[model samples]
Target: MYRKQLFLLSLLLMLLQTAAFAQNNKLRVEPSFWWTGMKDSNLQLMLHGNNISTMQPVFNYAGVEVKDVVKVNSPNYLFLNLNISGAKPGKFNIQLKQGNKTVHRYSYELKQRAAGSANRQGFTSSDVMYLITPDRFANGNPKNDSVKDMADKLNRNDRSGRHGGDIAGIIQNLDYIKDMGFTALWVNPVLENDQPKVSYHGYSTTDYYKVDPRFGSNEEYLELSKQAKQRDIKLVMDMVLNHIGSKHWWMDDLPTEDWLNFQDEYKTTNHRREAIQDPHASEYDYQLQTEGWFVESMPDLNQENELLATYLIQNTLWWIEYADLGGIRMDTYSYPDPEFMSEWTRRVMDEYPNFNIVGEEWSLNPAIVSYWQRGKKNYNGYVSYLPSLMDFPVQNAMVEALRDDEKSWDTGWLKLYNTLATDFLYPEPENLVVFPDNHDMDRIYTQLNQDADLTKQAIAYILTTRGIPQLYYGTEILMHNSEKGDHGIIRTDFPGGWSGDKVNAFTGKGLTKEQLDMQQYMKKLLNWRKDAKVIHTGKLTHYAPYKGVYVYFRHNGPEKVMVILNKNELPYELELEKFAPQLQGVKQTTDVISGKAYNLNQSKLALPIKAPLILELK
Candidate 1:
């Protein structure tokens, strides 16, 4: 018994020693960073440690030098700048010495990069982005619910509250997203919100440098990107440089007074995105609209400050390099200072040649939305490097057509048809970000007055027509806001997200066959596009609308996909021989959604009421 007690005491001592070593062995840094440069660039590192204040670490100096050591605001931090400019290339070791003691020596390898090895920024035509509000998606890890020492974690039950959906939850559901035929996933800001409550949305960032612990560590974010890339899915980061949450860490302890646009008082926005192209908009209106806070709880950022601008731009680049993300979705694109925005886009694109990004303009007018695209004849002459902007005009027209009117002049269906006719306003109409409905609004099914056929038609149009289509998560299985038509209910959790749930979308358990069919149908149509480049990169051609039916063709060279949507209840026969140009006497083709056969040249192809068909010519 004495011998057993002695062993237990020995084990306890060993654990104590290990704990002490771990605490001491930690090579800590603050305002974390990594090194990535155009060619050979300099890197400055700041590490805080005990008894290392005056210690000069030896480095292999692949053309590097320990230029200087400076004290930081915190006594524990010591900044070290390494001059990599014009330095020789070789592997190096970094070790610190304080009198007689030296830290565990660490080795780092540096090598000359080949030409054109650096990544480039720009988006492609063959990409589909799945936008997710990190907080509302899922609470995969509950341990981070109430992190102390930073922000207060309160009730998630509040509708305007934070629900603790972190980056980890998003990482967990990547497989589901990839399976759904989405090539890219956009997560709303994962940075520290630091708000006392309702930070689940993450739009109110306090610290640009720190990853919200509630979402998992920054390393976890990098892991999500790595895992997603392995699955052939690109991660698109949703960035908000316009404004921040009022409770951001910088609110009280700002890096500078100019860190925010209006630190003393709030400015309101005119919200006239059309003002950019508006001939009569006053200067005051433009200033207010672009400078105003999105809300009382949000503080506008000051892009005019060079330091703040640099910080924001650097942070974006850092995330791209660290996470290896495929794209970026900038929120409130028009609100930030236009000059800085152009510079930001240019710099980002300069780094990543093949990257893709989409900015949200949220204007229902084509003139307003088009003004933000890459090439535009703005009266102000704002040159933007942005690849694309959201097609809010088309989305608005579609919803209005399906919900409100179908008439002679400004009526139903006509709104959508006419809107498409104005596609000439856009420099590249096919490169727009086309989304039926998003987080701020009702589900597409609900917006269509629960008309499943109409919903199907809209999906078919967006997917097969032009641009890239983004669908909300629950839209596939016909989830709707039928009872009260609330957005919260519309964004209800997918049954398969939780374990032991009565319904399982993954397994099709406990769901009606109709629900299952809708899910299967969407999967079939979208997954088929993975190989359907004819529909993706094809040119679009359409004639004037006629008799409640619209026909458009997506053609590339010899490959052509004729898409027709019939809004009429009864089938309206088409004069295939006369009007169907290139498709003359064509009969056999495969249905994109159902793999059904169709004889286009035969007696008016059997189409259901408001049916949407995609015929792949044989």
Candidate 2:
């Protein structure tokens, strides 16, 4: 009797311990939920838990079939592939079973997609994009400045530290943005950047699905999209596919051994972007460029891993569907595997045929940048599906043209004229994104040596040039950086972003005379471009630079406009006889900026010094 009682007590204790262990373990499903009506009828769920590979998933729903169960080297992960071709929008239960006992039950849901989600229009030449770094734009919610769970806290004194800016700040200023004549808003990354330091820039992403609590919730981002659309403004999302933050959840328990490039050890990239297109390059150099990590804190993603590639591709589609994004700006476009990038863009473009995605190649060579644009017939048989690329070549030439002296053919305005002549290399030159400066570069005012007139010329050229135009925040108010090559200072806080600030650019309070004048100048130019169809889709004709003057014309049918850029210290008379083809039937011209009128019948027209003259020819 004593032996029997001991055995029963021991068995009871064992059962209790097993029950407690089961209760403590929690299962996690990536893409916790999905939607129906996706163009692709396939779905892959990554299940993570303590030794989850030991069990099998079993589910029964009409039109939903489990096609494959993939188990990687890790015992904590299982990739369940399903073909949900005809699945209805509803909820179903998935059971993880050990023998006959069910250990975990997960309720999976299939949501209904928004109507006409796939056919949404993307930002184009008809729209002007306004770029803003959310952390320095404004502070709408001070409570989230220092999240208890996130390590980085608000430090207004520290230039690199996070401020209190949130999505709510942007939502509050939609009226101001709309009033400025900007039709599209491209904000820096707002996803979760849980790094211990320097999280203000938002380049590092720790979570793929969640927005940073410091910035706001994912719902707030959705609200931004909704509110922006109401104001007739499109929202462009900045995305990074090259790497992820070291603190990402996958780093703790990797689904596969090859999930990250150089998984066994840390190796920095050589950053030899040209190696990919170099015909005589060695395989060793190419591998290091594509597979090496960006930095110690950013783990380079291995898109070659089929499972990981599918996950990333699905993640991008999810955001486009969830947030209703107008376009995408892909960062570090040349760092990833070329084949994988080709497939990535193909998948996205297939789903949304009308969507546009611009990539950041950062190469000054038009040949290098043109290689990534769609419809390019490469000599090495490389195919790309990207719709557009940042026109870095033109940007560099424009800056040099404005600052260099016109003493030689290779110097001054000739550099800009030569760069524009290279447009034949691009598949669709009009689709490229042209800008005077961006967040990564020094402000245009600072780059132009604090000369407001040269800055105005740059803005005028970008707004009138072919392709889409993007203006950085505070550019309208002549924002400049005292220290060059410093990202923190370059992206300084706006005057009216925070409370108690003396100057508010939004309200034009406490601003210098020059600052207010530039603000009005930008307002007029932007609003004028909003309705200028000739500039949007016109045939560009140019007369080579003579002395210190450069001339170009934008003409569409009967509508015509002449642009003259002068780089002289003194006003001079510009001979109009050389532009007879374009000026043929012209009688009078009105300046778009000063609203001053000029007669075009004379052979000579007076041009201002160091200023841009946009004349509406009649």
Candidate 3:
């Protein structure tokens, strides 16, 4: 038991030591010296000092008092955990004296502790992530919009340029987001982007260690996480390890020539994601795609370089520790060097055991996306430690189904029903991050042909089904592109983001009734799901598609939820006893969105055409 206790104490000390390195990076203190935040009055203070093999604490003539001391495991790695004595509640310079010469003086500031609340620092699969591009979202702080000498000047007038939607703007809207029932929020890369044109998207990272001053200071970000935590909202920080903005500070002074991977000129990715996981892939295709730069403006990172690897690893660890991020959404995850990428993910998992991270591998092939998931034996024998992957296979399936045939199992709407059938490919099907439309794709409502009923049904399924659900911002109102393929129009400004604006989803002002219902329905389902443990941690069982109606079940031991997705224009009567035997005892249920009653046992009720239904057994 004593040995076990020592092991835990040693582990805690190691974490403190790792964090201490970032404090100032100039300290050569002995490893034996450590501090613990344990509140027990009886604490241990292990010490190692120069010029003396051993030491003891003794009080002086001044009302100064010293606590107990204990020898620890390491001669150099000492522990310092002491009981409070006649010390005042302020900054004090404590002197460590020896026989002839006193070598150490430590300045410590002691303050009253907080109420000791628990921090919600990690996320689970049930969270629905809402992605936002800071500059494109809203401009709440215009004061810091443009700096006089900044190379990347602010351009509100420029459609592709930066509009100052600072962190302050995001903080001001957490209430609105929480009210909308989103469990997690993922903003685009908020690090400093010193790039010249089109830095507005916040993806061109200039500095990984610091938050962009154009948004707000690091302190403001911390406060945002703190506030979001109170509402049980998890913050998923978007990170890009593959590349950095060309105008980054590192460009002026690189730590090494090999800081970037095979980078010299701007080149587009081969866009052959299949080559990375294909058994018959060519070596030339692999090297050109993974090792190449996105463009002349974005330099690919050299994960193979040891120094570069450590720098990035340390930088990621710093953000997770500093902001207490719930999870990470790694942008362009497949573009990095595969082996070192595994090491980077493994180190993060080693440091944060309970945390979850998702990588964006945009592919319609289940095998391709599944290859990145943890514990998969890829075609190349590559093993990854990544926890979750975006369910792009299902996303594409959904889009194809919306456009093509719905009945045939080989393609179209049947493709979506068939895609979930391959859940065996994923290590944890429940751990995937599911979404309708994100910042890059067309809006969900638009993709569903702007049918309010279909949009509502998609929300019902995404909220109650397995995996973490990420709702794109402005999705509730069916925001879409005025033109078919313009991404800029797809990510339009939220109406009330600017002054003298008309529509505001926050207040339901000037919105159509259908739009309001869309908002309410999403908020209703998500907020209700916030407390549904069965839905969050349940085992999912899906049935094959029948006449364009898809059915699935989420069961946790005995409690279960039956979700039905009907895309047909005609209402289909499901015989409860036939097809899906699991729906046997299901009777009365409360439809999450409308609070309406549904009776499924020994009865035939017409399921709304092209809508979804969540029926919980009463």
Better of 2 and 3 by lDDT: 2
Q: What C-alpha lDDT, on a 0 to 100 scale, does residue 328 get in candidate 3?
A: 93
Q: Give the local distance difference test score of model 2.
A: 0.92
- Those runs of model 1 whose alpha carbons end farther than 4 Å from true positions after fitting are 1-31, 36-117, 120-123, 150-156, 482-490
Candidate 3, residues 279-376: lDDT per residue as tens digits? 78899888777888888788888888764675577567657756778889999889898888899889888766677889999988888899988988
**Residue-level lDDT tens digits of model 1 in 143-185:** 8867887555745556666566667777888877888887877
Question: How far does residue 6 in candidate 3 sit from its true spot (Å)?
Answer: 72
Order of the predicted models by TM-score, top scorer first? 2, 1, 3
List candidate 2 stretches off by more than 4 Å.
1-24
For every model shown, what is its TM-score relative to the native structure? 0.83, 0.96, 0.80
Q: Which stretches of candidate 3 lie over 4 Å from their true place?
A: 1-121, 264-267, 407-412
Candidate 1 lDDT at 372 equals 72
- After aligning candidate 3 to the native by TM-score, how far in Å is the CA of 175 from where it should be? 0.8
Query: Candidates 1 and 2: which is better by lDDT?
Result: 2
Q: Judged by lDDT, which candidate is best?
A: 2
